[model samples]
Target chain A: MIILGVDPGLTRCGVGVIEAGAYRRLSFIHVDVVRSDPKSPQDRRLLTIYDGLAAKLDEFAPDVVSIERVFAQENRNTVLGTAQAAGMAMLAAAQRNIPVALHTPTESKMAITGNGKAEKIQMERMVARILNLNTLPKPADAADALAIAICHALRPAGAIQGGEREEHLTAAQRQWAKAAQKASRGRTQGRAM
Target chain B: MIILGVDPGLTRCGVGVIEAGAYRRLSFIHVDVVRSDPKSPQDRRLLTIYDGLAAKLDEFAPDVVSIERVFAQENRNTVLGTAQAAGMAMLAAAQRNIPVALHTPTESKMAITGNGKAEKIQMERMVARILNLNTLPKPADAADALAIAICHALRPAGAIQGGEREEHLTAAQRQWAKAAQKASRGRTQGRAM
Candidate 1:
């Protein structure tokens, strides 16, 4: 299966493509989507991200697309940017009816580093080690996109092959996660105050 | 001075621009950079983001660009994507000789809502309140980009004016943050295990 991994951002996005099934053959496809002067006007910036992402989809077609799911609430600006990036990515995939898989940051990190909280240097080292590359991917973002692809490669076939794996988290699991998140938010607020 | 706030991502980047120091005129911009494959080949995807961002810059011509500083460590993949987006944005601004300011998530949140851990709804409400807008900006990211712009407007003139801001973070601060992060990682690892 050919899995496409995307590290979505409002300005610059990292994209990596990997073909796995037998031997894993991974390739670096693209990295960085830099938007300028977000201060100008809203419609124009949205149009820029939409058009740019569409062009990428047209250029590289894959069986499945994998993206990092964002769950951050601390930085309102960053969270919103990430959510928009995620939304735009989903929209692009939805437009083509392509199945998209969202992976938590932990999932990708654990899959690559065997440690959920592995530092960037460690992750990059692992990527280089697993891929047998002579050097690390420059600009850590590229390494991360590659790591997400690796995570998809390591998952069981059933978890990712048929597009059956892309369903939302189980209702109970979602509820639990949400509750935990709410609790966490309360704690953070208490601490801040 | 015109300050532009950008929420960058691979898909859609939310941008809001406002004129500061006078009547405080506000303008919003949203740019979309959608890639078909989040995991497209790196060169292709990078080009897409670069071109899209370049086009937006040409259109906006912002004097100062303010972006959210990423502090996400739990989601390695998300952080990587955000870093890439931020990198692209910085590079674009550098090319234009425009001053760039990076704000931590907390700073932006506090600036907007008077609360560092404010909820998304709270942030949206505050953005509307501060901007005196009838409603919140759509897609959350748009509101955030606008918030970044507003944050810049609120900063002391010496902090963000005259191309005085450095393009990157100081090494000492980065090391300190990373060291603290590493220590936190050990704690989280112990708990997870």
Candidate 2:
């Protein structure tokens, strides 16, 4: 499966994709959406992000998209920008009908490293090691994007492709997919009813 | 005076400088830092950002460095990466003792266009028109960086430098500088104080 990991931002978005299997293929792309003109309305910033990301999605078509989940910060302004960037990524994935998985910082770190609270240096080292690259990825943004994709690759296959909806399923696969489907239904019904 | 505008990232930091007055000069330099090894640590990423940016600052010896401020978003991941990118810019400028000036989207737009809310196409057109370039700046990031420096040039002398000081008084001639400084104060103080 082809998985695209996104590091969304108002000014720049980092994207990396990895194909699952022993001989995996990887591609890294960074999209910069220069913020809208100050003379323009605030809403235009969103549009700029939208258009920029859409162009990127068009260029890199992937089966799955993984984005880092939002984390709390002290700055409201920073949080707002993060939200806008995340929203843009979600919109892109939804528009393309691509399944998306949100990976937390800790989850990505733990997957890359043995520890969840791994320092930036540690995570970079682990990412480089996992990818069998000669040097660490330059620009932490790119590394983080790659790391998110790595995290998704390590997830259960059913969690990603909707286990129940699979056209063909082994007996064991069906058991897991059925349970997952039931759980999803229970959560949805819990919310609806 | 020549002002170098840098968009610092680990992989690629867009560099552009513009000098005004009797002899006008405009050049766009792209610095690419790629680590072939995936297992490298995150500190290595920052180091690459530092080494690449420092070389440019030395080679160009810009009078001032104008940069884009890091704004937050809903995606904690993007915020972290952009913050790192902005931090790299700040460190590179501060290391050279090259006065740093930050321009917001609005101020940059206003300087390029009469309105703060001008569209990206409008700002790109204006950047090309004002600079008398035959074509639009390739890679919007480069254009945005140049636009920022152009904005700085149009502002009153010493506006950006003076505004860097927290206790400074605003100068009417540098309204954009004053406003940008005021907005950046909260984040700047965290680093300075």
Candidate 3:
């Protein structure tokens, strides 16, 4: 399965595409950052993000799209922009009938580095290692996008299995698990991205 | 000039169209609400909003689009959805090269009732009176939307002219003026919605 991952942002949106090979092997297809002029109108910037991602979807044609989910606790000034960018990405994916998965930042870190609280550098290093890349992905946003895709690529087979394991998790871990479950519920229920 | 005004929301988005005739006479063209099922996935809901608004823009072909400018202080749970919906409205307008204008709640209230703190019923009554509608617009959202369009229609010719009048304003009024000016700046500067 090919996955398109989006690190949604207003000024700079990161997009990464990866193909899952036999035995869970992954190969990179494309990675890039779509930048919008901060000087542009908010709606125009959003349109730039939307048009950029729509073009990428057309070019890459990934089977599924994964994006970071926005939470209220994020930086207030940028949260709305990020959410709008994510909304654009989801809209692009939905327009094409591609399934969308939302992964939280902690879930992405855990997927890449086996620790929900892994530092950015560690997460980047692990993404490089997992993808067998000699060099790290340029721009932290791009690496972050790749990490989101990897999380979806390595997601557990079923929520039932994940739920069964949740009983053993700590409170914080359980919270993350529940949030992830709520996000992933969209995959099955055809609910909001 | 024609204006399309949107009261952006996730569950129910209000849309109104009005024509600004010579001598500033206003006539209502259309008003209604676009709703999305809460049970639908986030992406699906956004698409429903985008598609609905896109269709309106196509049919109305308004000269400009006006929408409520989102503030960070709004209800936390619904703010992101509202922002995303507003972004969709802006995108629809931008796609058609329609000039987009944003008005705050205070601005809309003030424009309709000559008082920034006017109650909903007051704003609705003024909207009905301004449009010469015998019956009040059903659904408060639609009336709110008509107020936004009317605000745009009656807006001063330029910010510089409004700024000249700011010396006579109260502290709270000056603050709202500044916010409105900043938002209007984005329209000309091509800044984010």
Task: Please report the candidate that would top TM-score against the real structure.
Answer: 3
Candidates arranged by DockQ, highest first: 3, 1, 2
Top-DockQ candidate index: 3
Error of 1 at B91 (Å): 24
Model 1, span B89-145: residue lDDT tens: 655666677777766555566556656577978888887776667777666667777
Q: What is the lDDT of residue A72 in candidate 2?
A: 41
lDDT of 3 at A23: 95
Ranked by TM-score, the better of candidates 1 and 3 is 3
Q: Is the docking of candidate 1 incorrect, acceptable, medium or high quality?
A: incorrect
Q: Write the per-residue lDDT of candidate 2 for residues B1-193, one digit (tens) a residue.
A: 7788765443456666777665344443432232212243233444555456668778878888887655553233344444454555555566566777766777777666756678989998987887767788777666777787777776544444553543453444355555555555754543210
The sequence of per-residue lDDT tens digits that candidate 3 reaches over residues A1-193 is 8999999999999999899998999988789999999888777888899999999999999999999887654535677788889999988999999988888787787666767789999988998888888888887769999999998887654432564566666655565566567656644442233
Native contact fraction, candidates in order: 0.01, 0.05, 0.45
lDDT (Cα, 0-100) at A107 in candidate 3: 78
CA lDDT of each candidate?
Answer: 0.59, 0.60, 0.81
DockQ of 2: 0.04
Give the DockQ of candidate 3. 0.41
Q: Report the lDDT tens digits of candidate 3 across residue range B1-193.
A: 8899999998899999999999989998899999999888888989999999999999999998999887654535677788889988988888888888888787787667667889988888899999999989887779988888998887654432564576676655565566567666654443333
How big a share of the true inter-chain contacts is recovered in candidate 1?
0.01
